[model samples]
Target: MAGTPIANSSTKCLPEGMPSIMGAIYPIEIMQDAKRLVVLAEFLSQTRRVHIGEKMPPADDTEPSYNGYSVARWDGDTLVIETSRVRPDVLFFNVPHSINMKITERLRRSSPTLLENKVMIEDPDYLSRPYSFTFQYKKTDYKIGEFVCENNQTKVDAEGKASLQLQPDTK
Candidate 1:
């Protein structure tokens, strides 16, 4: 049987890495301080941190993770963030990438209430060249809500395909 598609990892309650996490339908909240900033997703309650103006450790010095290691600095009005050392298991958005993937994101306020993130993805092993996309978020008074993916009732067969578990009839 083929391995489970990375796109379905969320069905198994796994963290959906990087750009996919930031590009989700759910709203995200950002909290910042002098040293770092954090992004909090309303979906699955996932959190990501970026150390501002800090040096990123070599891949060998840090563990691979869904969000990887991120370092950032301010470029004029934009905050430039670069992430590397993501796990070989990358984005769950159907697009496949390799272990050498490096992601750069530029975030800025496009309007008084709108924030934009321009993302650039690079992976020579999986992509012919680098590619980019953008995600915009509107400032809202809405509170961030909690979501627990762990409660999903989907069942996976031995082959790694996922399906909804059918409840037995009580009639």
Candidate 2:
């Protein structure tokens, strides 16, 4: 299946942590200050913190991770962000990224109600060349709500069947 994780007994529909590419696909709320910019996803509740500029140095290669280290700079109306030192813990679809994975993104407001994100991901380990894509979001009056994953809350019964606990309605 194209763009889908490979089907395997050990493969999960989604990994424990947010995949690096999700930053561009999901609905994100961006909060910025003098020092850093925080992008918070409404779905998985993932948060990415990016340094304002080259002021913050990239993380040591020994500290590889999913999101890695992100640094951003403002180019007129566009915010250019570069991330590197990523680990292979998460996959881009079914393809795994190497520690050398690097991502560059351009975020800009297309309109008063529209946000656009152009992203490019590179990883020689799993990709023939860099892949680029763009994702956009239209402003909505909708509010973000709580999203809790029950994957870790699964329990096994005496019969050896796993089940999730259905939370009681608070309303």
Candidate 3:
């Protein structure tokens, strides 16, 4: 299990992307307006924009990127988001997915302090069929802080284990 590149990108301060971004270890900020919804992640300060009330373009027209092209609409009490053209490598973990991969997320509030997200992932070449899972996030009182990966020094040994090289505060 050593020498694996599971955190390869994160090791270099790259965006974790997609599902990885949804991990609860860090908090994300969501902002909305009449035209688009914006999500800001604590890691790398990554951002994803989901346009509201717009037609999703074919893959041919959507250029692949870390977060992919996304469009959103309201379905009664739920907010539905369709994402496509994500750089296959950034789809799930840092692992690669087929270019045909697609992700759809339906989010609704289960309670005043709880938000539920149902995610469906599809990739004809990588999966036998589509699969889905639901994730629930509870409202927290934590505040977002400035995160700068470069400030943390780290060293990876030959066995692929990474260690933090704690830096003394120069303040």
Which candidate tops TM-score?
1
Query: Could you give me the TM-score of model 1 versus the true structure?
Result: 0.87
What is the C-alpha lDDT profile of model 1 across 1-171, one tens digit per residue?
365342266777777778778885677898888799899988788999999989888879988888899999999999999998888876546677777899999999999998899999999998888899999988879898898885346776676578666677779
Ranking by lDDT: 1, 3, 2
- Flag regions of model 1 displaced more than 4 Å: 1-7, 158-160, 167-171
TM-score each candidate.
0.87, 0.71, 0.82
Candidate 2 per-residue lDDT, tens place, 27-132, comes to 5677788778887766456677788866535455337765677888999999888888766766565567777787888889999998888889887877898899
Candidate 2: clashing pairs of residues: none
Model 3, range 1-171, lDDT digits (tens) per residue?
Answer: 565443355775767767666654568877688789887888777888999899899878878887888899999988899887777777355346877778899988999999888999888888888889888888887777777788268766665456666889899
Candidate 2 Cα misplacement greater than 4 A, ranges: 1-26, 55-62, 152-171
> In model 2, what is the error at residue 128, expressed in angstroms?
2.7
Query: lDDT, candidate 3, residue 105?
Result: 91
| Residue 94 alpha-carbon offset, candidate 2, angstroms | 1.6
